[model samples]
Target: MAPLLICDNRAEVERERFVPGTPEFRRASLALFIASFLTFANIYITQPLLPLLVDEFDITPAVSSLTVSLTIFALGFALLIFGPVSDAVGRRPVMFWTMALAVLPALLAPLVSSINQLLLIRIAQGLLLAGLPSVAMAYLGEEFSPRALGLAVGLYISGNSIGGMSGRVISGMVAEAYSWRASFLVMGIIGLVGVILFYLLLPPSAHFKPAPAGLRKGLQDIGEHLRNGSLLKAYSIAFVIMFSFVGIFNYITFRLSGPPYNLSPAAVGWLFLTYSAGTISSTVSGRFIDLAGNRVAVILGVLIALGGVLITLLPALWAIVLGLLFFCFGFFAVHAAASAWANRQARRARASAMGLYLLFYYVGGSFGSTGLGFLWHARGWPGVTAGIIFMLALGLLLGLTLRDKD
Candidate 1:
């Protein structure tokens, strides 16, 4: 038997075989985007609510953040399991089951009367959600045309930004108006709807070949990816960039609510609209990366984000918002470049590589956000800004160091 090969140019492969913009491809991409958005939204819903949770649970700022931290931790770790499982099983079935499982926890979360229970459910939710991202990337690698893959991936990421923004905005407002429990219920319903749409629309993979399942093979694949210098640099870039991004947001509410700013919850909710800038930047940057290459685009993105952080130092409220918009724009641009670079660098087991990248990404969010909460607690916004600046510097270094081998 001939060794099966996953083609890099999915568009040409499909054109030689299947019709372009066929009902199947359109449905699959749309369904996957919806599901991706819902999963990501649920993961980030707690971000804007950290202050509320601190007051409600009567916990320290760091502890209160565990509601989000633990979820990302579980998500980061679960990628190891999900990546290989999708390779051994198949993308559609794994995605369907994982997404269905995710809905249950969101519903169950509102029923939990205690913070501990909520935390437990969130961990379970993170583990299940992990199945989607890694498998989704692998699906694109196997199914899309190389020329078109960048756009498809960018759209999926745009769904992530939209979901993240919606989750924070809606949850913050609902928590202010009703109770936090209501926020959970609303997201739960959204998850259920996403699941239905995903089932109805996601087309079956025509090109996937299941790997032979064994622990040794899985470990070897993972080790091979880790050994690649460029891939390792991409992973580090993801870690530092996400760490800086989440750390800033984790404490921004605390700053606004307490001091000279003293903004209301609804007012704070409006602030997350800055994420819209991220959605636009990701799409534009994706096209830019294809044209200019990852190194230049990523370096420019880091500088933009670093400048945005400096804007927050201004005492004026409008300046702060402007700063946030720039920060989000830079973050998304850098993220789009780095993620695409990872996909292109891995010659085989691309799903595992992407999963590893996300593991570092979210773990950076978890630890960086929680650990930096203390900086805000001790020295206020200055301390938090200083921490983020350090991360951005490291990210810039990594971006500059990136090299492609022909």
Candidate 2:
């Protein structure tokens, strides 16, 4: 009788999940994509504005980068709380309310009188922004059928790439034409629209079974994840990917903004059009993973990214653009593979698993954004390249350790 009751409950949960062809699935997918786009666009909108901030605030390159770095650092810390909180309360309310509130900080950015004020606003924004990514994956894990989950995750990340690209591009162009403040204003508007659409379209979670709510349980789950060597490897790969990608992009603006190129902020922003490659690769990597397995796919991604990094070393604008293209492509490939792996490897407390992954992910971005600035000051592009190379090598070695079973 007990076994039969358990079986019935499991079957009911599966039946309640969103199927691929259903309207609910489409709505949820689109809503999740928009949520991701909103999150990333706001997070990265300030990236291209680093040089402009340097001029406006009369600060060093490293100091100007703190606007981006501190936000990501705060986001990283926020994830640890939001992930567990969502598990205890619910996914939809946490995601929706936080996302709606995050807009305030973006609106406030334009009003800041000093760099410190701007940084404070960014930090506030980051803290609020964690509600989405920290729980979105887990939401999908619970709401979508197993067959649809891969493509859903792929599309979700494609939104991330597009959002990140558009934000930078918009900020650069807007800043060039008007001012950096206007860029934040634009982001805030888009965010408001996103929040409304998300609320309307996202079906409430029907399958989420709340975990026991407590700090001790959250810590225990985190401890279990830490004990899993497989998860640690994925975390390491995530760290290296963001570290290299952010480090390269953070300083590349300075390179192009100065020297022979002397490209304006808008021009530098256009180069991120290479991120279209990520959109394509992320969407397709799901299918590729089905055919090739995680190990092969990730190794290929690393090699492609590594090759792209080397290509940038050439002393030409074409080389740099081409390298960025390859780099974006490979970066998404690695992301698609590793993120899925992290989701699959964790058998329990799925949101917490994702939170841990993102904690490493953004922490890496924070480090890359700042740590590489000193390198830029000293050795320029070559030094940044060396640092990224060492990081990717570690990523490659870590990729090698992943078994196909994952």
Candidate 3:
């Protein structure tokens, strides 16, 4: 028997979702896109600064990496709380306050006298970062007409690509010219601007019905989704993709900033322009996914990503950048396809399924960004690359094992 979809109003929930080319649809998409932009930008802006942090704080490369890792780790747990809370209260209120409150910590980050104090602020910022991603998907699920959803989602994801690239470029440049503290200040300003625009643009939720806000109910709901074999595969895929991607980006900066390459921080930041390749690949991959089937796309993406990892092992700067471009391309493609696959398997339980996917995603990233530091310390960049490739291979194998009916 199929599980029931809980909602406050059946008629409202069952109504045809939003269609493309409408004014209201644009507003919703733009708002969500901006939300994605701010969250990703702020969270990852620290990537290029890892080397700078080691010098400033007199910390080891591994310890300096925690700024990104800890931020991502907090985001995972926060998703568990906000997903159910948004179900009960409302999406806009939760999203709005999360964005607003997150800004304060960013603003305060520059004021922190100790590294621990900065980490505390990052934790709070990461927690609030949760309000958008899962809820935004839920919002799109309710609001978009099925035919228009792909484009709507594409736009939202585009923001993430551009935001991540711009954040690193801007922060790294600012840190180079001034100080790393100034980089945080710039990121905080950008975040503030994003919140204002999001508040003014987003439409109120009409189909959103408050589910009962209870921890027990949310846990039970998540448990039910976990029982589905296909859903579990979707989750494991997410875990590996994020784990491999974060670990690579975290250490690449360290490698490039060292001896032979001797790149400046801004130069390291420029390399992230490869993320735009992801933006392009994600869009193109989406078109092929409906025809090629999700599994085929996922397997190819993992293989492509792994190939990129291998290219980075070469001793050429241009080759490294080219590798990263391919890596980002594969990352975005598989993510778009795999996420859609998971939601399809979950059927009516879309929100909970998304929450689980995100939970795995960040948990993977947190560990990837932090845990791989030991390998980096022991065996250099080659060790980190070996670890990431192993994870990618596992993900590819899991992708192959997924049956349509599972």
Candidate 4:
């Protein structure tokens, strides 16, 4: 009798599931995408401002790199706390408050009188901003149907790609026109608007089940996940890919704006529009991954990105632009596939798995950018490309080893 009742319950659950291509699914997917875009844009708005920061603070390239690196590091650390808290409390409440508070740092950044104060606020901003990324994956994992998950994840990542691009473009343009301080003010205003929209649009989760265990169980789950070889490889891929991506962009603005190019900030801002290629690629890859296997998509993405790195070695301006476009496209393709794959791979403590993935991801960005500054100084773009090529080669090797049997 008990077995029959369990079967009946499972059948009922399947009956109530939402199908793909429905209006409700589309609405939910779009809202999640917007949320992702705003969250990531707020996080990365400072990328193009590194050079401006150096000029304003009279700091060296390495020191100026901290303006972005510190934020990523804080974001990584904050996830450790935020992910577990979300599991206890629920996703929406934590996300709402944390995103709201994230705006405060952006508002405060322009008013800071010292570089130390600005860096402090940026760190705080990264910490607060982590709430969205840490929880959004959990939300998708619990809410979207398996058939719809790929589309939903792709849309969210599309938001990330668009946000990252626009953030850099807008900040660079605004700073060029006025002051670097103006850039933060704009980001704060946009973030406030996004917060309002997110609250209004995102529906409550239908499938969230609170973990039965306390903090000890959560900690043990994290330990178990870290010990899993496949999961560890995924985390490593994220770290290396993000490290190479951020490291290059962290200093590229400075490099382009000085010396041979002497490009204005507005022109530099336009370069970020190349991220549209990433946006498109991410969405396309999302559908492809759903059709093909993750391993194939990931391997192809690595190759494409590697090709982009090679292209950047050419001294011509056109070659650089073409390289950036391919770089952005390949990055999004890999990221969208890997992010969804992480959720699929983790049977328990999915949020924690994603949190750890992001932790390594951002830490890689922080250390990669700062550490590679010396390489940039010593050997220029050639040195940077050489390092990225090595990292991508390793990523491809790992991608080949990934088993998608599940």
Best by lDDT: 2
**10 residues in a row with least lDDT, candidate 4:** 14-23
lDDT on C-alpha atoms for all candidate structures: 0.84, 0.91, 0.85, 0.84
| Highest-scoring model, TM-score | 2
Candidate 1 residue 297 C-alpha distance from true site, Å: 1.7
lDDT per residue, candidate 1, 254-292, as tens digits? 788777888766677778889898889877886787788
lDDT of 3 by residue, 1-406 (tens): 2234345354354454566667888788889888988999898988999998888778888888889989988998888888888888888898899998888888888888777888898898899988887677777777776556556666776777888888899988998999888998988998999999999999998878777879798988898888988889989999999999889999999899999988999988888899998888777776767667788889889999999999999998989999999999998888877776776677654676688889999999999998899999899989999999999999999999977555
TM-score of each: 0.94, 0.96, 0.94, 0.96
Stretches of candidate 4 exceeding 4 Å from the true structure: 1-18, 212-214
Spell out the clash pairs found in candidate 4: none
C-alpha displacement of 23 in model 2, angstroms? 1.1
Candidate rank order under lDDT: 2, 3, 1, 4
> Ten consecutive residues with minimal summed lDDT in candidate 1?
1-10
Q: Can you write out model 2's per-residue Cα lDDT over 36-139, one digit (the tens) per residue?
A: 99998899888889889999899999998888889899999999999999998999999999999999999989999999999999999999999999999999
RMSD of each: 3.2, 1.9, 3.9, 1.9
> Which model, 1 or 2, shows the larger TM-score?
2
Error of 1 at 83 (Å): 0.2
